[model samples]
Target: MDYMVIPDFVERKGSLYLRSDHMNYSRATLNSNWHQAREAEPKNYDINVFPKPPGRNLHTATYERIGHLKSKGLPNTTTKSALEQISLKPDFTERETRKSMVDVASFGHAIIDRELDAPSRGFGAVLPRHHPDYDKLHLETTHKADFTPPYPYDPAPERPPDFPDNSKAHRRYQSQFTDTADYRRSGRNTWQDESGVYGNTEDKRTVFPRTNPIPERLVQGLK
Candidate 1:
């Protein structure tokens, strides 16, 4: 499902409120896309809403506003109450808000600040639809999937070598880890030699290359 928004808010007089523009914009985009998708391909397009993991009833209010905008009916949106059963850590309200309402910009900015602002890589996992962890994993994946990032974002990378897949179950399990290695831990100051060479020390605990370093075999005409 594509085209989604997680609204921003400002706390005033003990009540949290989103900007008029924010609500209007979100409603417009959502409604337009909602109708377009239904007309274009009613069967395939499914609108999935993901509210900021709640503070007070702000999450509910945000979704309610969008829901009200639709003349037909509200499409598929993940409810805050349903999310309570699942663990979506990093309290959205506290972590996602800006200093002032004016500072709270576009939905794109909010998503980037939520995922990329941190020192370490954010939450991720690849799991099959049948697995117990699949729902949560899919939730995280879908949240990020809706956004058309300025930079390229690949969810499933190529399967790595040395993956034990001799057995059928092992091969099935291999699918769950296609993107596992992509989310590498940042190796800035953790493992540096006196010469300041990263991953050059004997500890070997932080020897992670930023990208796949394996050299491809020379072919007849390939560079």
Candidate 2:
């Protein structure tokens, strides 16, 4: 009989001992020196693998806590430590006391008095005929009154004797040819009539058939 030997078990002095195949068995041993050496070395950590926790922001937190004190009617102690409080009393005695000391003849008053005495004239105001500036103004006005706009180079081109000059007459003349169907039919008939003159009867023959009921002359002699 053959007995199978277990790879993980070893027979030492008739006692079976389990063998350890761990790669770091030496470091994992129960030795005081290995433990002390590992403890003495500083541990290094990667920020990408082991991220740090986000701590509280003191600036934003402080601003939010004291934000309401910056508005109106609230006590702002940054600029001034002691602030003057306003009185709600409505006494008019001080205004009346200083009324007499105010100057009545100021620069503005002088200007108003001067204008009232002799007012200034605007551009639209008419000048007297005897004034020295009236002659130049009269000359400029006369020149403007005599001014005339220039005419174009081809203002009136020569027209044919049969062409109508008046708008109504021109429209009436154009109305004779305005019927496009009649114009096209007449043009086609004229071409057929004069086809013999050009010695090209193909167009006429193609347009009018030999079995047409109309006379040959009326059908443009297609046959």
Candidate 3:
């Protein structure tokens, strides 16, 4: 089966081997050219052959070591000063303690007063004062006189030239109802009827009586 394998199948199977051979050939060609160039120039391998030492030693002191060495010979004045300044126990002597308490109270009071007096940092505070619209905002915030009519002196349409007095006009209008016979017959004078039934009048000015009156029951209740 290997001998009878198709040529295309064999070529496809050996594609990786062919690619590796081509890469090796290219590498070998470049190496040969490099060797020839080196031989032509003939560089001396003995002269400073190893890489030059770094400008500074690789084992040079690190920051931690440098700081430790620098401070080793110096007296720790900073720590001593801090220790001296700090109070291990508060003094309860009456005058000193009272002064300290007063100072603390004053400090808190000063903070509160400063906060209260500080200018507000709200939107109104940041609004531009010089803007053209600022005047309109100021006007809106301020109180002004109530609006007067545009034509205050215009004599109110000359009063129709024949307008009647208000009392006379009202009486004339009321006469339409007061002068009618139906209005007179509607019993507008009293709230109760002659039979003592409340709100049973023709005009219905009050609530209607819910129960019919019994003469016998009324007489018995009265007795």
Candidate 4:
């Protein structure tokens, strides 16, 4: 894995990153994404698969990790310990292993050499993002500001039709209060106003005063 990236590679594991907007690096979160292929992969080719195209080989460490996972729930396993053992002889490297597991998925799948996809949220994933019984802050809001109120209170642009991100945009949307002067003086010097996840911007950084749209009476009602 170490041989695939830039500068002081193996020694600098924490230095590399997959920027949120940067596709050059990948943030590999769990086994499902790349692990599916590595966990139950076929044999490594014995010959020189050389000058191989990108996404052409299985990453050794990833394969080893997933391989360990595949052995779960077997009969002889110990109840005392959950650790799965993998042999780490000093002699296993891409050069030493002699064969390489080829990545047929075009993502190369090399343990250390390529960027792998992180696990995606699955079928029941939406559950974590919302509360079934509790009304979402913005959805089901009958407050007048909750809708497209009026001037100086116009709605922010819809993120997009499907938006493709969290419904934060749709729900967080409320009638704007105050005038353009208030917006300007509110210190909205930067676009990066973070409520939670996305405030961390690598572009330019600054702050601004933010005003909530919900009328005080409505907020008390919801509470």
Highest-scoring model, TM-score: 3
| Stretches of model 2 off by over 4 angstroms after superposition | 1-108, 113-148, 151-168, 171-186, 191-223
Give Cα distance to truth, residue 143, candidate 1, Å.
3.2
Q: Give the TM-score of candidate 1.
A: 0.11
lDDT accuracy of residue 173 in candidate 2: 23
lDDT by residue (tens digit), candidate 2, 151-188 = 53645777889973344322222122344345444443
Question: How accurate locally, in lDDT, is each candidate?
Answer: 0.42, 0.41, 0.42, 0.42
Q: Estimated TM-score per prediction?
A: 0.11, 0.12, 0.13, 0.11
On residues 1-223, what C-alpha lDDT tens digit does candidate 4 reach at each position? 5667555323235543322331222224322244443444553341223345564554433222333455552344474344433344434545654444555574455465333353234454422443464674655446665675365665588676764443343243322342323444345373443344332322112222357888999999999
Q: Give one digit per residue, the lDDT tens place, for model 3 in 1-223.
A: 4677554423353243232322223222342244444443333222223346554354532232222354454354787978975574455334542334446557756543334443455445533345455557444422334565565585656667686434422222222333444444355563323343223232242233355577787888989
Please provide the root mean square deviation of candidate 2 (C-alpha atoms, Å): 25.8
lDDT of candidate 1 over 1-223, digit per residue (tens): 8878776444456443334432323333443244444453322222333343332333333322243355655555568567675566555436554566345355445543344343342244232235455456444566577876888777887778975443332222212234334334345543322343233233332333245455455443476
> Of 1 and 3, which scores higher on TM-score?
3
What's the C-alpha lDDT at position 12 in model 2? 57
RMSD of each: 40.2, 25.8, 24.5, 38.3
**Which segments of candidate 3 are over 4 A away from where they belong?**
1-129, 138-171, 176-223
lDDT of 2 at 100: 41
